[model samples]
Target: MPWIEVPDFQPRRPAQAKAQETRAWYSIKNAASEDEAEILLYDEIGGWLGVTADEFVAELGAITAPKIKVRISSPGGSVFDGIAIANALRSHPAQTTVQIDSLAASIASVIAMAGDRVVAAPNATLMVHDASGMCLGDAAEMQKMAEVLDLISNNIADVYAAKAGGTRDEWRAVMRNETWYLPEDALKAGLVDEVMSAKQAPAEDEPAQMRARFDPAAYGYRGPAEPERPKPGPPPARPEPAAEAPAPALVISVADALTETEVAALRELAQAHLDTAPLDPPATTDLDELADEQPDDWAASLAHLTTPAPWGQALEHLTQTPASSATDA
Candidate 1:
């Protein structure tokens, strides 16, 4: 009897371009705590410059931490790669926690379900839709592709049904409509276990900052709602000086005294007059003299220009010519 020797199998390394592309999309690092690790999926699932399933699984396998955290901000990519990554995470020994930092759309939303506990930031968004693909061939090939897409969509619907509280058919309907969920909505739907609110006061532009991290619109999502700009706050109260003489009352000029609406109305009236009334060189010269010589009186006279009658009277007084006289002349 003769025993034949078996050759050792060596896996082929990915092409340099492929390796660089995948490296751009994800990072796996040990957390500050020795027993925990973190993974960031900040790009699409699988494409040029996106994370690939094989690369992700290989890196994930290298981590020995008992607990793992996967932070996602992606518009999603290849569905098959996403499925593979999700399954790998689901089967891992470590207790996995998924955090949606900004967005998890399409297949990325599917990967989020692999976590034992899924959490989302207050402004984070999750989107789900029926699986889609492109096929170029004869009628048979097109039909086959359609079947494949339907099968993939069914599997995705099952994943949703398993995580959230609904039948696969119900989830499929929602997916067909291309549903998007905010953190709270996701919680209600059982897609996320928690919507984590900031314990401390967030930065003034926190929502805008979070929004900058991902653009759901690029992937055909409506994207997160625009962050409300913070209103202008009143100036801080000044401390009184010790035993000082009372200061003169602050004087507000006529310009400052006018409300914004009044100013706008006056400007509109002036613009209308300028547009319609013929320019009189002599009247304009006299008005300029009045404005320059008696500036205080000019301002005080213009203050009454908020009303139509007062505005006409003021304009007549400034030009020293009534509309009737000008028309007759």
Candidate 2:
């Protein structure tokens, strides 16, 4: 597929208020003399990475850069987006540089590894762990999840190993431990090539407040040339975030959230996965929608379950909401 340039989504900034997730932004200062460009990830709302389908690869495309540098300061959002952008970077032909100035946890780590050159500021951090996503269904349902998880584990391993130049088993061991590595330690683990001191970066104090945060427009980059946004159509009804119980020793599925087709999907996904093989879990859609469509007639909804997993890895990289009881209500 051709790369689609999209508009950036970021919280508007006033000089007075501090930027929430933006770590910082820097440019080569000269377009001709400077062959370098940058990608920034700092979305305020946890969802969407503050970017949408149209906005993907916004920064990477904006600067017309041959040597791309991505500076990250994000808490992390949907793993789907993280991997999407990371995959985009992998496809990049230029010399890519990924700089971690702050925390790169969860999916952010994938983005960090997209770089051919990965560097971290002294205080920067990196985290690795098992891939996770919300799930629905019963015992048979959960059995399927194991397979999908196995695949996600491999994908994650491939990323770290490619960047770290380490064996996959050793890398998997690092993820199994699920530890966050600070700059010095991460370098020791071969996750990064160098940890540059503040002096190594351009001369100036990055205000804790500024964090060099700015909207995509402020950076002199507009991913794709788009006209003013049209007014939104009537707001679609929001889906309920079915209240989840505290992490149970075992994750139990709520009947209201799972129906026949969903149950079957979970079963198929699980069956596909062997002890070592990883399968991608099906997507979490409105089970209510699935329930209404009988499997025989509905291709998109009910039948969606039994089909090959909707996606290889879950787009929503979070845990399934455990069933919440009446007391919470």
Candidate 3:
């Protein structure tokens, strides 16, 4: 027989590739109400054909376990989807516990905030930065996007503040600097409840193991760099208390940062911009038309665009709802 050359020919596989081996997003296992639920959020946050709020809701809704454990290792993805997933976790009727097995950077860190009790492995990492977006349009459109990003950033900062008991401005500063937190730093910043002890240390799983979409190194990450050690010095004497202790006083003042009308106008503007040019789109569309076409989707997108407090509220409810139900049962 003469040797023949084949064109565009390939051998068939004996079996289909596992979803995890190819897909950027996949559920390791599904849990029922009675089972100890475990959700593995390992990979990109969004902006691909991976996990979405709808998928997360579907998977999470099936698991009615009183307490749910979430293991996270992601470089982060779409800000839009990030907030949505965070909200879903927050609203779930389970006592959510998050374990940062390795890295939770960008929006992944925001999702971690949904946990009632978050624990990070000894060498785990967390990062936060201002919400980012890419716009394609004239100066006006760019300005519109900048304004929207500001709102989104503020909302993210609020999530951190709500969980960590810090002012939004303080969190904003950290985001501005693209701050990264080690396990100990995360605990002090209220990003995590505890750091895993040596005995409880999780096995090493490098970033490549995830096969995720986003790159953790994009942020120029250098792992958890340690602070310089202090030089040895003599112990100082303790200072004495003040001669007279000041009496504590309480006062309440109501302040309006923006008038009601201004807020409504800003919200309407945000909605209008998001519908037609959320990132980039055709020139025109009526706000009412967009809302009427897909009200739930529109509202959810609006919620993500406007602020993050609603997500926080959902997490708060999830935390309390499970406790209340357990007590009632």
> Top model by TM-score, which number?
1
Give one digit per residue, the lDDT tens place, for model 3 in 1-329.
Answer: 11111223423333233223323553535453344588887888644433345556666788767888888999987677778778888998889899999999998998899998999997999999998767777888788878888888999999999899889899899999999999999999888999989685344753444434456688898678899999989899899976896788876431244446555665766577556544644244888877787678668666655675433443343356776978867
Candidate 3 displacement at residue 195 in angstroms: 0.4
Deviation from native of the Cα of residue 106 in model 3, angstroms: 0.8
Model 3 compared with the native: what TM-score?
A: 0.52
Better model by TM-score: candidate 2 vs candidate 3? 3
Q: Write one digit per residue (lDDT tens) for candidate 2, span 84-149.
A: 778878887778788888888877887888888889987898899877655567776576676677
Q: Model 1: runs farther than 4 Å from truth? A: 1-16, 48-51, 200-329
lDDT of 2 at 238: 95
Model 2 lDDT on a 0 to 1 scale: 0.65
In candidate 2, residue 282 scores what lDDT?
A: 30
Each prediction's whole-model lDDT (CA): 0.82, 0.65, 0.74
With candidate 1 superimposed using the best TM-score fit, by how many Å does residue 258's alpha carbon deviate from the native? 99
> RMSD per prediction, one decimal?
38.2, 55.9, 58.9
Q: Provide TM-scores for the models.
A: 0.55, 0.48, 0.52
Rank the models by lDDT, top first: 1, 3, 2
